[model samples]
Target: MTRYEPAVDLNAITALDVHVHVESDDHGHFALDEELLDASAAYFKGSENRTPSVQDLARRYRDAGMAAVVFTVDATTATGHPAISSEEIAQAAAEHADVLIPFGSVDPHQGAAAVQRARHLVQEYGVRGFKFHPSLQAFSPDDPAFQPLWAALEELGVPALFHTGQNGIGAGLPGGRGIKLRYSNPLLLDDVAADFPGLTVILAHPSVPWQAEAISMATHKANVYIDLSGWRPKYFPPELVRAAGGLLRRKVLFGSDYPLIAPERWLADFDDLGIDTAHRPGILKQNAAHVLGLR
Candidate 1:
């Protein structure tokens, strides 16, 4: 029952991967059901090491000389599958605190219970932040019903990382397994950001099909940020690359969407994007450090 505390030496880590998933527990329970897991593997194509446990992830990131923020999605109501325990994940991460930062997830649909659990994850277990998948969770970020959860996080003074734009979780399944892409639109989070200025909101992934909107939010809102994850750098939208080099440089962070997209592969492709030399360090590590309060 030890509370987690980061032991990472910022100087020792070359990067902080902010979007890694701990899809399984030490007990062999998976975060997502077989159908969604298989679908995501197919969608990512290069998802070679899917379903790694927290310990496995710690070794992988540590070997790479990096730190990772690991979390699992809790979409119990939407997927009808039990989620891997965020509490357990946080406790496990405490053992690998040097290279692992744990972020908790609660089914937003759980209402008051969700808020209570979020508080416990932060005040008790010491989770650094919270992760949400709007599409997979089947809830809109700006929906007033979930405002209490956001308000709780705001009060707790931790960031909220939302999966925006396209999701690979249920990709290619019938109706994408009822996971609505519309829920993940970056614009939906603009309201949440506006409403909760105290809460830092990170829009995960490139927000494809709405890259312009994502850019607009990050540029216009001080509370909003974008994480470069889920897609290879070579395939990044031109506008996003341009913004990352200039206006959004400080507001953008690096992430690998690990297990699905390895950090090694993501970094190799990032080198080819021709991003400004000045912005590289911030994107690779500094920005993430600031966002996670590691600085």
Candidate 2:
């Protein structure tokens, strides 16, 4: 099969939403196991079908006059649930080149194969980035076993995003269904960021209980960025709002972990943030454009 690739026309879009998911494929293949899916849905109390085809996502974003970076995480070994096809997402994005950007995810626990997949997704499929969920993927961010995976992506010049806080996947479950929150401790990534300075790292979400650490790390590391997603701005931690709206202004990018947290709801709440309207374009789009190497 031909590998996935997307040719985005940056000029055609108004905002680049950097964190969106293609939760399920058309064939009823889900990105996570059934139990986790159910548990996650319950945590969010979401009644909608979160999983939509990449084509559907393209239409959703296009209608909003926006663009999205879509990817499905591969936790095959960890979750023992086959992941949605990265190649398929990429190919679909290519078809919707007007609005979608494809990211590839690799189960770092897969070691060598993960490195190979990272290469294939970039060199062979044209993925611009990779996503990892240290908690769900069952790997410590600083583990040496996955060094090769980070090395490959770094060498390829693609950014890496890690889900870094209380995860929806296992929330409110009996024992949180064995998903360890400790694995996602944002500080663990401090070592990875230090070791792979060339790798552009994104510490996704609010990183609760460790929000201070997340903010400190992003402030200390030039290559580290934080996407404002997974939580509404009105509910934002006071410190995060201060940093994004003032202190770490350029270091923050807007991302609506769409479906779970719709863009409309996110933007509506974000509208109240005392951020200067003049900087809206930058936070909502230009910052990501700069991070993603677009204009």
Candidate 3:
């Protein structure tokens, strides 16, 4: 199997979408169970194909003059459902290296095995970073049991993008399908940012209900960042817009949360936010490039 290496020409791409999901494998296997999948589709009012393979993502993003960081969350142990293989995703991404950058996921509940797999994905498969969903994975980011995994990632020299705020995965289900929303609170990640100062921590989404906490963390921590994804820019909280245009411009990155929310729709709404022209390039591409070490 060929190892993944990015061949993307930075100048050719208009933006870098930092959060995109590959929900299905080339085979028929899906990343989430049918119930959760249907719930999410309904939650987003999505009529489009919800599950897109890595190749489909590459072509779509390339057609839009953009590049994307693609990944699947391994919530296998937490959900009792198998995940689409990160290894396979990375190998497939290598074939479309010009437009696809792969990020690896490991079920945090697996303890030592998770750390080893993370190392293998980065060293052998060449994943640029990692993705985590604290709620779906049923693990607290600041839990003492997971310190080793955080330490390993810090040593690996890659960022960890954690899904914070609202999640569509188990929305509207009984007890939200046993997924605890409290685990995703951005405040929980503040301890992680403090403990692992060397590790770059990306707080995904605007941290709804806790926007102040998210904004504060990214503002206070040098290694912390926020990605504007999942929600359309037109609906962004006033403070978030203010921060993105001012103090947090260099710390905010672009992400579309594709399939559920298209990049085209996200960008179209972003244009109306009236952020300063000077900060637009950094939010759209430059900041993400710096985080991904593409500079």
TM-score, cand. 1: 0.99
Query: Could you give candidate 2's per-residue lDDT for residues 174-237 as a string of tens digits?
Result: 8887899999889999988899999999999988979999999999999899999888889899
Model 1, CA-based lDDT: 0.93
lDDT of 3 by residue, 1-295 (tens): 8899888888999999999999889899888888998999889777356999998898898899999999999998988898989999999999999999999999999999999999999999999999999999999999999999999999999999999999898899999999998999999999999999999999999899899999999999999999999998998999999999999999999999988899989999999999998898899999999999895
Cα RMSD (angstroms) for every candidate in the order listed: 0.8, 1.5, 0.8
Model 3 lDDT, residue 290, Cα:
93
Give each model's whole-structure lDDT. Answer: 0.93, 0.85, 0.94
Candidate 2 C-alpha error for residue 150, in Å: 1.1
Poorly placed runs, candidate 3 (over 4 Å) = none
| Model 2: residues with Cα > 4 Å off, grouped in runs | 1-11
Candidate 3 Cα deviation (angstroms), residue 15: 0.7
Give RMSD (Å) of candidate 3 vs. truth.
0.8
Could you tally the backbone clashes for each prediction?
0, 0, 0
* lDDT at residue 283 of model 1 (Cα atoms): 97
Q: Per-residue lDDT for 131-229 in model 1, tens only?
A: 999898899888899999999999999999999988898898888888899999999999999999999999999999999999999999999999999
Tell me the deviation in Å of residue 10 in model 3: 1.4
lDDT of 3: 0.94
